[model samples]
Target: MCGTCGCGEEGTVSIRKPGEDTGEHTHSHSHAHDHQGHAHEHSHQHKHAHSHAHEGHQQHHESSHGHEHGGNGHHHRHEREIQLEIDVMQKNNLLAERNRGYFEAKQILALNLVSSPGSGKTSLLEKTIKDFKSQKKIYIIEGDQQTMNDADRIEKAGAPVVQVNTGSGCHLDADMINKAVKILEVEDHSLLFIENVGNLVCPSLFNLGEQKRVVIVSTTEGEDKPIKYPNMFQSSDVCIINKTDLLPYLDFDLEKMKEYALRVNHQLEFIEISVKNGEGLNKWYAWLKNLSL
Candidate 1:
């Protein structure tokens, strides 16, 4: 299971391209599955401690202070759990730094786009890919819990794409991005967009070595989403308010959403866009162009 979200299990994650053999997929459980190994090691140590305890069992029966050690044991277990979480995050950060270094050396403009489901993330990508493909060499790493539907759409949009179906994984980790980049053979001096799984929570915790993290929230979702999921907004570098075309039909407050987002992340750059009608897309394209410059 993922230590951060506890959504994925051993052998539950897989990375593959579209139309590839489903039987030939990568089993990636390196994140939280390492806890199982740690547990085994602890168990082995416990057996030795058990033997020692058995040797001292007679002394405990004769002593009146045997219960005093119980509190210490509970404290030690709590510390171990805290340490385990630290270990998981530390390991992820180390890999993320390595991926960041590689991107820097290659001058690859990698952007991690994150959002909740049905936030028009894929649609924004499709529009961006179609509009910018002619000027820049673009590549995509599409992430989802299951299915290659987004990947297929990206492939048709005219960019080299790799689909990572994370089975039960809630978010894409640095290790997954490292592996996907190798498979995609991403070119240097090009655009690499990692469309993270449609999740607001766990995806914000894992850094995929992207140069910028863009969070997309639609107007249809409540204006209070920024405060509700502050971590996602706080960690994001850019906030894309997508699906602006539907504003007239719904009871959505555009200014209130921006106000809430600013409260969470004052540095977050906002781009209002409606992929359906090409509203504010030039600004979006301009932002992407400025990144490459």
Candidate 2:
């Protein structure tokens, strides 16, 4: 569920390559769920609580599932929400550490690319794969609510790609990647690009055990975006200021955008690139190269 918009169902993650044999590589988690009486999730779009009715509570059971005050069993909703968040994140963090260890043992570089919709993440990836596919093996795990459109784009760019259809979910968690990695049969000493669901808030709260988190933002969206979505920026290791090729026709100020982002995260590294026309992308390629060193 998106912490910002509460827009996900308590469900499983599905992973498959577009046009691949279902018998060979098909995985789904339809039965997975939390056991906490009434579990709620937060999405990037909104905050809505999802509840499930449970038995064995000492309080009087209301038909409407509302909490009525009782002698010794009434608990505050706010406290419940806090506890839910802690439980969700704690489980995710443990799995994320496992993922980190797995990648470390294989000498794989996993990078999580997070951003809002239409941030040009796919284009940047296509360009990266086209250039470096020969130099190193690159695997892509594309996350979207539905459809394999982005996965298709990455595949045509000549890279190994898997699509994770999150159904109503707004972000991908570490466990989902664990399943994808098994199907991907990823190679060692390679790059694994996890293009997380197009979200700025919910994805920030879920870590996938990636070595670095790259937040992509375009100039057309204006510089205030970083300030508006500070949580995403603060957690990210680097910020990619994309669409520099359109800077001449627009009123976007590059310096101010970085300033606003830096206000939230003082240590974030910035990369200015025009993935469309190949401007200022050497730093990006160079950065990736240095990661292996």
Candidate 3:
């Protein structure tokens, strides 16, 4: 009796030698049926490699004879299998759908505000909330890895606010928005603004059930930002060139930035504003009204 098998000698274990054309061999076993008629199959023509087994004590081996035969043919097959199995960005898309449905149910016009830190997402929201407080019941969902500072500013503007701390997560997902919505007392005629964690990359991939996605690009960040971070601009329905008040001080090319943004996303509607001076905000508010309506 073989110590490894723990089975009788009648149970035969056969090992086959690697063929001349064989680069590598792999084995997979399934015990759905009895092993009495089990057989192994091999192919030399197939560049990719895979294995399937049915109820058998099968052993596979590799040989150096064909090791350099087009650089590990079996390894390439394994890689293809792995690539096929990957979801890529399925998780994020699914979560985005859930968030979208939730917002639809609530009848809340949610807006995702994305930008680099210090691009004045907070200040823009602050000014907007102050101006629109009398006419609209605005609610804010502030997302940050730490601190309640943004939410605090929104609160001072007299709008209902909820702060979501994502911990180490770089972006907000549907689950976060789902929970954040509960804390916000959004009425029938209400606007929900989600201040996405300041990031040009990660935030664009996430959808927080927002009616609109607005990307804030500051003049100080330069006109090349639209070209460099095309994904963010591409995803946004609106692009706000904030801090235009400093355009005189900085050598920012406004026309070139608009041209680049249009090249990337022809449908992008934009507003140039400075929250400090309250310039270009009325146009923004008007656009928001038309969208919400």
For model 3, residues 1-293, the per-residue Cα lDDT tens digits are 32112333332222111121221111111232433234222334332233442223122232223444455544322211334776656665676678777668767788999998889999998998889877778888887866667767777888878777554557777656766666565776678899988989888876766778999999998798889999999999999999989999999999999999999999999899999898999899899888777
Assess every candidate by TM-score. Answer: 0.80, 0.77, 0.70
lDDT of each: 0.84, 0.83, 0.73
Find the number of clashing residue pairs for candidate 1. 0
Candidate with better TM-score, 1 vs 3? 1
Q: Per-residue lDDT for 159 in model 3?
A: 80
Instruction: Give the candidate order by descending lDDT.
Output: 1, 2, 3
Best by lDDT: 1
Error of 1 at 74 (Å): 25
Q: Which candidate wins on TM-score?
A: 1
In candidate 3, clashing pairs total 0
Candidate 1 Cα lDDT to native? 0.84
Winner of 1 and 3 under lDDT: 1
Shift of residue 159 alpha carbon in model 2, Å:
0.7
Stronger candidate by TM-score (2 vs 3): 2
Model 1 Cα lDDT, one tens digit per residue, 1-293? 54324664443656777778662366544564577789768856765665444443554445434445444442122111233445557767888999999999988999999999999988888989889988789999999988889999998888888888777778899988898888888888999999999999999989888899999999889989999999999999999998899999989998989999999999999999999999999999999999998
lDDT for residue 85 in candidate 2, whole number 0-100: 38
Alpha carbon deviation, residue 193, candidate 3 (Å): 0.4
